[model samples]
Target: MPRSRMLEYDGAAWHEDCFLCSGCRKPIGSEAFVPDNRRFYCLACYEQQVAPRCSHCRKALTKGGLTYRGEVWHRDCFLCCGCGSALAGQTFTSQGERPYCVRCFSSLYAKKCAACNTPITGFGDGKYVSFEERQWHQPCFKCSRCSVSLIGSGFFPDRDQILCADCNSDD
Candidate 1:
């Protein structure tokens, strides 16, 4: 026969009343008391728990759902404010009130052009076989040889390279 162990506190010995599984309140051996949620439970009931997963990444959601703009989204499924793109599987997070996609967000760091000293709105390979190197907006720089603005012109000529109507007429 096995001897029953009495519950003991710092300086007092006591016996538990109504031994039950803390999770399901089912009867259990006096020795099976497992503390949980401020109550004791048998091992079997504690092992049957389930946790929620995030809808966006399908990972366990440790915290909970986030409410943004009146919509509930998993922390990972939120969209960037700048590009309106989904933000799943990304390591970076924006602390701003609105999020931004990687590309649109990087525009914040773009520097102004050195030649014209204007904000760089766009970029392209500035290579004309005949002319020296130059960085220009589509409308800013004319063909070096023609001096005509290359706004709507289908083509613009450099020293030897033929240019557009504006460039062709300038010289």
Candidate 2:
């Protein structure tokens, strides 16, 4: 065959017409192509055959997507397991393989604060106090009689009430 126009790719020289898409079997003719294991493919063919699929929607991911626990997901398909809300760019947590928004995760899984009866998230600077198998937000861990903070002070635990030394002596 006489070589009029040729292309050199991956150390092989071929006539321009012979360099074709592996999937569509059409002439590549210098349009953008992807080479996978010595096989050349056009963008459309590569997307269909080689691109990773979203774990939730099972669709090829041609644009931005996320990988969690070795599973792929489109941004829109990454939803909270507990509330069915979009989780992209938001604070989220996972229990096993399912993802949850922060609000839902806290409501469903966080330990209940003994004093205020709200979820103790244990996130950020919001520290907690634990005593007698019960937990409370740091601010809520106060003396039952004086309403004073018991964070660093010695206290007495009588039934459900936590009394500071002064309050305990007065009682």
Q: Estimate each model's TM-score.
A: 0.25, 0.82
lDDT of each: 0.51, 0.88
TM-score, cand. 1 vs. native: 0.25
**Per-candidate total of colliding backbone pairs:** 7, 0
Per-residue accuracy of model 2 over 31-68 as CA lDDT, tens digit each = 99988888999999988998889999999887799988
Under the 3 Å rule for N, CA and C atoms, how many clashes does model 1 have? 7
Candidate 1 minimal-lDDT segment of 10 residues: 122-131
Q: Where is model 2 more than 4 Å wrong at Cα?
A: 1-15, 35-39
Overall local distance difference test of candidate 2: 0.88
Query: Mind giving the per-residue lDDT tens digits that candidate 1 earns over 11-63?
Result: 55444444566677665655554555556556555535422444455554435
- Deviation in angstroms for 65 in model 1? 8.0
RMSD in Å for all candidates: 12.7, 2.7
